[model samples]
Target: MVCMKDPTVQTICEIYEKLSKLDNLSPSKNVDTLFTQLVNTCIPPYPIDVTKLCTQIQIIRTKLIRLCGHAEGLLEKHYSTILGSFDTPLDHLYIFPYYSNYLKLARLEFDLLTQHCQNPTRFAFIGSGPLPLTSIVLASNHLTSATFHNYDIDGSANSMATKLVQSDTDLSNRMVFHTNDIMNVPGSVLKDYDVVFLAALVGMEIEEKMNVVEHLAENMAPGAILMLRSAHGARAFLYPVVEPRDLRGFEVLSVYHPTDEVINSVVIARKCPIPTVSSIDHQGFVTQMTCSKCAEIQVFNHQIEELAMEEHIC
Candidate 1:
């Protein structure tokens, strides 16, 4: 839907096209330069109403996501290959370009999870890519005892990820990878996890994203934590935006938008114990089955909404 005549749209399209066709996806001078320009264009230095072009940008979001996935896979594969040769590969995690970002993100998620569940026994990560750095970092630094179940649709990515962590004796026992679509994962299996982390790139389209959310809502244990990655501001062009309303069976606890290099915003929610009421009473009161979990979520959601507005991050 983008107008080819518009200079900004044209530039973005051109850059995306070139980037998609590139044979070498590894970190290189040319790849970095193109990605830099693309980022600058998508997120300008000065605010200029990027939302107006959101519809147009969304038309090509699937392609952009695919390109990003492929690029990330290549980068991870490269790193995995290099690290596979080392005896203490986990110790050399600093060599990764986005190692710092992963560390910060994992820490943030850990803090958020701890707020609701003090001592989580197990967690599931959907769409954990080839490197699975977030899971690695969280297991290594934060929750040392918690079992990690990583799910990825791509068998090759799962294979690569297994290779990366298989050498680490600590992680080898705790980290488990499943090569299957999250949709196919049974509810019985889902209810076992104390917390679930949905990766940013899991669902490329809004419908797909919502379907996954709905599925999790139906399956995940009541009061279990669900942490998902979304995007805000201009970053929505790169990743799907998960509004609070889209989470029907979950009570949103907090939404954190990072303005720095960490692209995906984090949304933490807890599954409702029972079905939530969809309508308001004549007195304009939200009618719901009252419970301890509902009471806590209502208080936290109100505070989070106010904070989001003041921070302009929701």
Candidate 2:
């Protein structure tokens, strides 16, 4: 049967054209059958382009749908087993859309942050969940030097991330997976990151959140960007939370919530040098001073009259 020309058909045809070039053809038969079924199922009164519809169906069937199925299967088989051991059901603990939104916002933020950097940069993702958005972003483009370090508290999540990274050659060399707590991410291991991502960790206690932030602030080099997203308001209250206080060395450039249900905020902080303090001696009392101008605290000694005099003059 000849399919009539239509936008749907046109889209299908475009997708088919692209699929024809893929070297992997093992799934072609299944894809073809799925495509045909989708085209046939479309409500019909108007003329439809079967070929074009089939093409578009193939693209969706082969790429997005298939990947989604794979991801779901992986979660059920791997993630479910691990989650079942815990007291809470997997669904209760995880807010899927929250993570999904995080991925979307992270990509947009990363693009904005790295617009000026040269091709093939490195990034570190703290509290990296089952799906590492950073790996996806790096895989989206052909970056020769792009590398990702995904750190998470869950062994299962890290394993899943490793599998995802290794499955794609483009991501294999560029991604590294670590099963580590965000709060305990070693200082030596954290440095020179173009982008550092923190997502969904808002459910964690406020002290833990601040600890993670402090670690990032202290370890990250100058000009590094921190991308974060979390549930705010009542949702945030689910965990023993701490409001973000002023981070001594970092400046908050912007704060925003992308959606009403999700209190997702992004704080892009630039690192400033930590001022050093010289010891002061005054009347056998000692005090250390960070800086007189910044009001940074320091120790001072009463014995050093000269240093005290200098401190007073400043």
* Most TM-score-accurate candidate: 1
Tell me the spans in candidate 2 whose CA falls farther than 4 Å from its real position. 1-103, 115-120, 138-145, 182-184, 231-244, 260-263, 274-314
**Model 1 TM-score, 2 decimals:** 0.81
What TM-score does model 2 achieve against the real structure?
A: 0.51
- Model 1 regions more than 4 Å off: 1-11, 21-27, 40-55, 276-314
Model 1, 8-64: lDDT tens digits are 667778888899788987778898788778776765422323345556665666578
The digit string of per-residue lDDT tens for model 2 on 226-270 reads: 656533322221112222344444544444333322233344445
Candidate 2 lDDT at 308 equals: 41
Locate the minimum summed-lDDT window of 10 residues in model 2. 291-300
